[model samples]
Target: MKITFITVGKTEDAYLKEGIEKYVKRLKHYTRLELVDIPELKNTKALTEEQQKSKEAELILKKVTSQDHLILLDENGLEFTSVQFANYINKRSVTSSANLIFVVGGPYGFDQSVYARANDKISLSRMTFSHQMVRLFFVEQLYRAYSIIKGEPYHHQ
Candidate 1:
């Protein structure tokens, strides 16, 4: 199955962008990897956090399709070990969806509508990280998960 990562804004840090690109290249050796960035909302100084999230959610939802299995990378979502995460990826591949899409929201996180549309939610860690950094972390984890799945000796207990 093709895996897609949909996130808000650009990765402004050169280092972070390079790290994300490295993993994206590695992940392609295992499966189809699609990286999509939804532009950040403009002129948000007057908007409430909720309003910003709502507007962001509109852009996010437009990228999704009915055939895609939507998952959100949320702090409150389920946490798993590296092996368990690999297993989760394996399980998802057997499902009917052609694409398994993972979403990372903006600073205030996802709106209620976006949450409702999600089929599952995953947490990378309990500690908070910037949204841009999360893209790098998630892609690296994706690469790690695939390596584990293939018994490639890239991960150790």
Candidate 2:
């Protein structure tokens, strides 16, 4: 199955951008991976945070399909260890899902509509992270998960 990471906004810092690219490239050795960046909403001075989430949700939903398994990365989601994450990946690999989509929402988080469409939610940590920093962290965790699955030395018990 293809794994797609859909995130809102651009990675402005050069270091974070470079790190994200590195893991995205490393992930190719395991399976199909695609990274989609949804442009941030403009003229948000008039819109409330809820309205912004609603608009971003519309854009996010457009990239999803019924056949895809949608997982959202949110602070309140389930937290998994590296080995457990590898198991999660292994489980999805055998499924009929055409694509496994993991979304990292905007600064204000996702809309209620977006939550309704998600199959599962995962939390990288109990503490919060910047949306841009989460991209690098998530990708690296994905790579680490793959390494654990492959019996590589990247992840220790």
Candidate 3:
């Protein structure tokens, strides 16, 4: 199955961008990987955090199709070990043909409507990280998960 990774804004840091690209290229050896950057909202000086999120939600939802399985990378979502996450991905691949769409929301997180549309939620860690950092982390984890699935030496217990 193809995996769609959607994030808000571009990775501005050159290092972070390079790191994300590395894992993304590695991941493509395993499955189709689509990286999407929903351009950040403009002129937010007057808009409240909630309004910013609301506007972002509109853009995010537009990328999703009814056949896609939307999964949000949320702090309160389920946390899994590397092996367990690999298993989760394998299970989904065996069970469904739908695209696995994962999203990293803007600074304030996802709006309620976006949450409502999600089929599942996953947490990378209990502690919060910058949205840009999360992009690198998530892509690396995706690569790790695939390596584990293939019994590659990329991961160790």
Candidate 1 wrong stretches, greater than 4 Å: none
Worst 10 residues of 1 by lDDT: 90-99
lDDT of each: 0.93, 0.94, 0.96
TM-score of each: 0.97, 0.97, 0.98
> Of 1 and 2, which scores higher on lDDT?
2
User: What TM-score, to 2 decimals, does candidate 1 have?
Assistant: 0.97
lDDT of 1 by residue, 1-157 (tens): 8888999998999999999999998987999998999988889999999999999999999998888899999999999999999999988887565689999999999999999999999999999999889999999999999999899998999
Segments of candidate 3 deviating more than 4 angstroms: none
Cα-lDDT of candidate 1: 0.93
TM-score: model 3 vs. ground truth: 0.98
Per-residue lDDT tens digits for candidate 3, residues 1-157, read: 8999999999999999999889998987999999999999999999999999999999999999999999999999999999999999999999999999999999999999999999999999999999999999999999999999999999999
How close to the true structure is residue 72 of candidate 2, measured as C-alpha lDDT?
99
- Scored by Cα lDDT, where does model 2 land? 0.94
Model 3 C-alpha lDDT versus the unseen true structure: 0.96
Q: Of models 2 and 3, which has the larger lDDT? A: 3
Distance from true location, Cα of 82 in model 3, Å: 0.4
